[model samples]
Target: MKILFALISTVLAGGVRYIFEVANGLKDKGHDVKIVALAGDHSWFKNLRAEVIYKPLNLNTFSSIVYAFYKFYRYVTLRSAKRNPYDTFLLISSKLGVRPDIIIELAELIRSFDSDVTVATYYLTAFSVWFSQNKNPFYLMQDFPELVEGNEGKLGLNMFYHSLKLPFSFITVSSYAKQLIVENNPTAKVTIAHPGVDLNIFRPRKANSQNQKYYGNIKGV
Candidate 1:
């Protein structure tokens, strides 16, 4: 199955690395994995088997302007074209070739790729899923979309931004993210997909006398 991991995350951030790990793991299973980066930053995905889709303008701002214009043009054509907006920061950083925007753009490029599962994260990616011709849209809510501002009033407006139009079910990485989402949207159907740390890399240290002696000799000599 073709899996498109729409990434709208910064390089070196945990999110980007997670995408790479998942993509690679999928590829190892002989599945096709493609990365949709709203902003460009090819270096991070260098070793991954996934293909990165890059867009020129930022997904956040460019998408907003596009959404605005799309809203304006909707009545003209008598067609309903609801625009999907992403974060402002992702848009601006896209110019600098940010990885997050690249992921957002990848989701929009849905029409060109045949995908069974479209794991969408960020608002822009969710919009891409909405654009899909026949793909299962899955929203990955990593954090409280509204609590981002730390103000209830702004939270309401931000929620008004796009929460009502949120796609299929949501899979969050943390209780905090899921908690905030559930609070704002009690009826919102969201599932928690707890984030994990690689045991070999993040496990507690175990010191042995022999290893310690080697380290001590290496440090001294």
Candidate 2:
């Protein structure tokens, strides 16, 4: 099975680890997985076994005019590069080749790739792909911030919770959170992945007798 996973929380504390493990498990099952990411969220998983696709374009946040302007600038620059002309860069679903009709554009990019199952735990990250794609979408809902102070921009997260009201099979992180989702959406289905840590990399870090730095500033520090 080919799976497409898209999200913004890959920048969160446990986001990269969760994505990596999920992708790793899927690959172990002999499945092809495609991951779409914005910001620097996918850095840790770039070398992972599954195929990772990135658009390198960020969406706009209604934080302020400056942020909005920066998003526009980046979008236009990406368009000129002839990578995608959705009037914005397609982060995950350029294969869709159509404008994002949903709340967020990046979601559409991911879904456009024509994967069998698309999973998103973040709301707006799931919106675009499920909105445009004709494939089955699986959303893994873990965190929904009530208020984001200095966390990150309100680009995708806020949109998912507010603007998009799409149907999805939700996989919640906790039982309490699952009840909350059902209370909010009676028809929404919830499943838990019972998260765990990978023992392979969780072992103690052995210190080396000698240490080297990549740069002078790093070396001095």
Best by lDDT: 1
Task: After the best TM-score superposition of candidate 1, give how far the Cα of residue 42 lies from its true spot, in angstroms.
Answer: 4.2
1-221: candidate 2 lDDT, tens digit per residue: 88888864355357567767789888989998877765444455545787666554443553245445556776687753332332233343333433234345566567468788888756656666566564787777766555331232454345545522467777776887677677667888778776776678688777654543345457688
Candidate 1 weakest lDDT stretch, 10 residues = 95-104
State TM-scores per candidate.
0.60, 0.61
Candidate with the greatest TM-score versus the true structure:
2
Cand. 2 Cα-lDDT: 0.61
Clashes of each: 15, 9
Cα distance off (Å), candidate 1, residue 48: 1.6
Residue-wise lDDT of candidate 1 within 106-131, one digit each (tens)? 54576667788887766555666666
Off by over 4 Å in 2: 9-12, 45-47, 58-103, 147-165, 200-221
Error of 2 at 66 (Å): 9.2
lDDT value for model 1 = 0.62
Off by over 4 Å in 1: 58-108, 145-147, 150-161, 184-189, 206-221
